[model samples]
Target: MKMQAEVIREGELEKRSDSLFQLWKKKLVVLTKDSLSLFPDGHKRAKGKELGFGSILKVDCVERTGKYIYFTIVTKDRKEIDFRCPDQSCWNASITMALIDFQNKRAIQDFKSRQEMEQAAGKR
Candidate 1:
């Protein structure tokens, strides 16, 4: 669900549809590159799928109490989630990831924008 603007040379503009001129297309250039860094280097793409992440969609974290943190993750199909974990390490990563996901969700206009991705992807 990303887009780009590419100019056509000569008189090719008239041959193509207006949508082709500049439209938001689901291009894998960003996904594949991201997949490479998120997953292992030799990781292979899942078969028969537009996205390798076939199940889980997003992750969220919430501070429940003084010593408790909650994780709320939604699936690709809008599934409900209410998970609570007392583990500090897990909760820390969860909170960090959620914060990063929010800050870098779509603030950048460019796909190569690695602002939020790095903070979340780091080995903390």
Candidate 2:
């Protein structure tokens, strides 16, 4: 529990606001993952296996303009991400598909965890 709390606190990056999404369209979300639950659909689209921390981002998208792809990050306080990568055509669709699956799985797991906790409390 302590480790999980520490990880959540450390792993999070501040959320960007609606205005930044309006201005830029989308942003990439990365995971410092050791292993990701592989997705079948996404597996078909992969150019190659992502190795270690070399996986630049798990997903990328442009938010506002129908997801016209770009690379930038602007926090809610209007802080700009100075970091830039070489212009590359990102595989948005595949990444998006995989991320959706990941999120659904997480949601289910969270619900189950809550149920178990509630059951324990009732028994107590």
All candidates' TM-scores? 0.31, 0.35
Residue pairs whose backbone atoms clash in candidate 1: none
Query: Cα deviation of 85 in candidate 1 (Å)?
Result: 1.2
Over 1-124, each residue of candidate 2 has an lDDT whose tens digit, in order, gives 3231111011112233346454321223343223222222233243422222222234433433342344333333443432222234343343345445555667799999999999999998
The sequence of per-residue lDDT tens digits that candidate 1 reaches over residues 1-124 is 6643221111100011125353322211113311201112223252312222334566655556655555554556876344454445354353344334444644453444575567678956
On a 0 to 100 scale, what is the lDDT of residue 21 in model 1? 58
For model 1 the local lDDT of residue 44 reads 28
Best by TM-score: 2
**So what's the TM-score on candidate 2?**
0.35
What are the runs in model 2 whose C-alpha is more than 4 Å off? Answer: 1-90
**Segments in model 1 whose C-alpha atoms lie over 4 Å from true places:** 1-53, 91-124
- Report the Cα lDDT for candidate 2: 0.36
